[model samples]
Target: MLVNKNRSSAGFALPTVIVASVVAMMLLLVAASASTAIREGLYAQHYRRLAREAAESGVVLASKCLELNNDLAQWSNSAKLRPNTDCKGAVVAGRTQYIQQDGNVRTTFEVGEPERREGSIQRITAVGRTELIRTTDGAVWKSYEYRLAGQAGLSTLLDSVSFGYATGGGFAMSGAFFTVIDEFGRPRSAGFNGFGQLGVGSTTDTLTLKQFNIPANKRAVRTYTNFLSHGRNMFALTENGEVWGAGLNNHGQIGNPGQSVAWVTNPVQFALPSTDNVATFVAPLGIVTFVVTSQGNVYAAGLNEKGVAGINSTAATIKTPTRVPFPEKIRADAHSWALDSQTAYAIGESGAVYGWGNNEFGQLAQGDINERRAPVRLGDFGKPGKTKAVQLAFDGDTVYIRDSAGAVYSAGKTNYGQAGVPTFRLRAGVSNRCLAAVGASLRTENCSSTAANQKWHLDRTNNALQVESNPGASQNRCVEATGHNGEETRMRWCAWWSGGKRFDFRYPTNSWSYVYLSNSTDIGGRGLCIIEANSATGDTKMDSCEYYTHKVYAPYNPTLEQVASSGVVDITTDQYFATMVYANGEVKTFGLNNGALGNGVYVDTSNFDTYKRQAYNPTPVKFILPPGVKAVSSWTTSNGVDSKNGNTFVVTSDGRVFGAGSNVTGQLGIGHIGGGTNGIYPTPQQMLVLGAQGNLASYVRSGYGTTVVYANNRKVFTVGNNSNGQLGDDTTTTNPTPRANKNTNPQRHVKFY
Candidate 1:
């Protein structure tokens, strides 16, 4: 603590001088650290760029390698990596291969192998590493590692170009026939010309597109047609807001005064009065046409038998376009109508989806199959009018939705796993409680949405009840009976393929709806039904199917798939495809995958591609998310059952999206379509659509062999099957990849009421 003020300057220094020297030393050390940090920062940038280059190189090599191997088919080891030319390496630690380059800019690349390698496309990653060096002597210091993901293999993407812009806002297709208005306002068409449906002044089919006989110089803005085999009417909206039609005139489908003629034979302007000239969209399908005017009014023509036209008319057909009683503007398109099934979905201006026509399978999500004479708004899974839908598509009895959140929901005909969730909940008629899982045992408990224990999904695949998910007892477990009378029912392991507890869910008339175990007997063979115990005990037991003391309350449809005491058993032919893409990138897929679920599980043909329907909850699709990156959004789609195949798509944290599954029609939009594993992409192939002012699509909507993409809500693109000109490229040939359809599509005036 003592300081000397005077000391020999050469031998000893003053306290202040010594302290100042120490401080200077400390400052020098800090400066050295800062310099080191700045150097590392620069090096980090260089390494990242190097890593990205490495990834690019890997992709380039793989592209050549896959080509050499004929897309893995020609590879001697098709299931694993086989070095080809400059692509040298092996399947090291699950990854396909490792590529090393010699230099100070050290680089290594690895191809990421999925659980299965069925597709021609594959994913690869690269690493760039560097060593720290001492600035004084240039001696090696420490090593640092960096991983940077860069995309490549876009040669095909660059080849795809836009079909060219046309003022014609939209197009429509049906039964190998397409109705489109070219940029020159000519109504061109090709494909099936039955009943003069081609409107080319003749009834001969033409692979080459031909123009309609509309002589008027009206710039067409919208075109409408149908996929229905029954009525192939085509309608077009003019820039002047006038409507015109050519094709089937039966049922007044062409706005004719009467159904005296079977076909229009030419493009004739409709005499229907429309002071509502702000018509922006025209939807013609089945046997009806709906014109959406900017004034928030919908006008309808043609068949009115099911009130699909929404005119509420007793007259089976309307000769002229009549004002429909729709409360808002009709938000419709080519896929909006499926009138052949007496079912049609109409999007209201309020962003609400309305359904009419056949409700036979509750495809309307109305909770009942009662025929809807007029359009009825559909309810969300839990409540009514909560979700705002953007678009909708149908595959048989099942319906697919493109809602506001970029997610898909399903409904109707769930017996084959079409319904994404438990169609209904069962309550005990003997008590106020509901049937629930009490520690893997069946019991009566207070019903609440806070837990999934009370929610039961009927497994039509095996005729058992299963608990869907967590926050409750027996999660992912199924109900089973010992085939003994008065035995307590318990929740146990479920076999997705088979061996699920075979309990027959029965709905008996003039009696209670019960779960019957036919194997149960009392010293003699006699069926037993699951019944409720005392309200205080919250226990469930098996009793005679004729037990009069208990009842089962199904809040929704009771005509579910089950073994009736003596009636019909319903198993929907529709494929149940439900997937949830949570904000955190977690996905839950329920029901069936058309061909393969991409979870290393495919169709078990012996079981007819069927898993124990509803016996299992939503299963997770496999992929390891990289650290610091998670899934932000995803798109999964399927058309048929597990036998037909489907697709799964996901967007990653790196702003990239990938597709896996059937590319039979090039639905994956990766530029090619084929057979077997070549078309069935069991692993994900990155989607980087380019060309025609291309950019990565922000949203994707895949249809039967066709995919439509919207980029930042400004541009529209399509790929896959161009059969019938569905790709809107003015060509009927298959489009191997995505191309721009960026026409003058009007900004949707979606009213979010």
Candidate 2:
């Protein structure tokens, strides 16, 4: 390159000037390209960040909407444009800001609909926009937009609520006793055959809301008393402390105090002082009598099968209230009553639950399945410790009791896992003496393991346990041991006790401890649970559940009358009642019986007065979670693989979320069953996917079971039962095999595990 320096006195030649200008232009072009690349990178970063923020903002917005409306109605329809409505056009508690650091750039967020399902916040969508900060006219104005959406599912997958009907047609205080609707859109009272629970004190069933007297003041003036079921009959305690018995009293669940077989029609007086003349005795008085006929004391009456009358060794049936024993030294805390065939239990105030009569399934909790004649102490606490009991509930043979500390304990016949523990008892190390201990000891431990076939043997009889040709096996297939018989033909699978011996088998339909049944005709509503007490929003805490079911049909007739035809109209719609539980120690009943828990309540009934039209409904007390739990869910199974490496979550009964719902294999330790179109549940329960430890799961879709869940732990687990390669395992051997496929990779299998 040669410089054309001019020979002229003052300046260089025009050519030289032109060359210098060209070089300068080239440098400018290079610098501009570099600057453009940096700017583009910055823009991309901002866009991603804004998108995430927008999605989070949408969730906050949706929560605010639900707070005000209790249902998804707020997010269901579009709202008119307003300045402060955020992206969803709803006012939220949090503030959102759009920032622009670069020159001449703009960003905005747009909101979309909210999808609520299965007691969960399924999805929320939002958009963020930004405009160019600099204009063509040399002005600065940034322009950009981003859209984000969020889907918040339930914390757990286990069905916490369960419900069932008592029998005897119609809503009755004594008969049937369906959990009916109340004015507040919750299940406050049970429908009785008579006005006992109806409050009219009549035998006629009130089919219309008008038939029942609606007090001018609709506040729940009466707290939930006690509800007892025995021998096909149901007994209820009122806020005024009065006792009402209905149904059959063949066992004397509703008899008078100190007497045997003395039955009352409706709410009857329990033990008042007895006098020969009896001129001072009062009837239909608002007196609280714990004893049926004994005045001012705890008494027993009716049939005394085995000296259960508490009459100090009396074996005869008393027709009147008989003085038993009501310890006055300690305040009679809370109490609960349940019956299994001819036996019953009365959990008392001092935190002591007692039992008598039948001993089937060991419901008496006396470490033995023997019927008692009198009330025998079951245990100090529902479990082993001194933790005070918060509440006690009974469902058939299962008794559920939660302590003030929020630990749930259950015992009795866990045929359906209502007892909340593994029902199988391993009989590995057994001898004649060991069998004796097994019969006496209430606790047991698992101390045996076998890589291949193991056999059952008596340690005393032989030095070596004999392995049947194929111990724990059938013909040619291998199986895992299920805590069933130790000695078998080929040890390939285990058998868990299904109530007792001779009932151990592997069948999917009956695999689950608690099976889902039909919706309750007595207690009708969606599922719900009680999360807190003294809630400012209302007297209780609740959540709602959605179920996939056939279209519901309205009741066509009530007592042979087409009530809808008359002006005294009754509306019939088929929707499950949302669950809600009151602070007054009352559990509202609702929805399907198998999955309803928490403070789950009922919403609708065949009786007109049984239905509440409010947008928000109440239910009975669902499953009580561990306290301090903001959220409750079942994200894992009993397998060790689901230890919540930030995959699963468990909420304390107090409504706090402890961990995330991460999948370890297909199982999550957070305690939910599973998630899929066919696997997803309305209530929170524990998940039992089989695979190695660590979060690993993949689902096909909501219900279809396309997307499979392969665990990240070198094992594959499938939700919705992938019988083929969808589960990613080499073998298609385990159809509905609730075990991990160790041969497959775990990362590829993705699910909401």
Q: Report the number of the highest-lDDT candidate.
A: 1
How much is the lDDT of residue 6 in candidate 2?
Answer: 52
- lDDT of candidates 1 onward, in order: 0.53, 0.32
Clashes of each: 8, 183
Write one digit per residue (lDDT tens) for candidate 2, span 457-522. Answer: 211111111222242234222221122221111122223222111111111121222111111111
> Model 2 scores what on Cα lDDT?
0.32
Candidate with the greatest TM-score versus the true structure: 1
lDDT of 1 at 196: 68
> In candidate 1, what are the lDDT values of residues 351-399, reduced to their tens digit?
6667776654556766555667677776552135454555565544556
Give the Å shift of residue 42 in candidate 1: 64
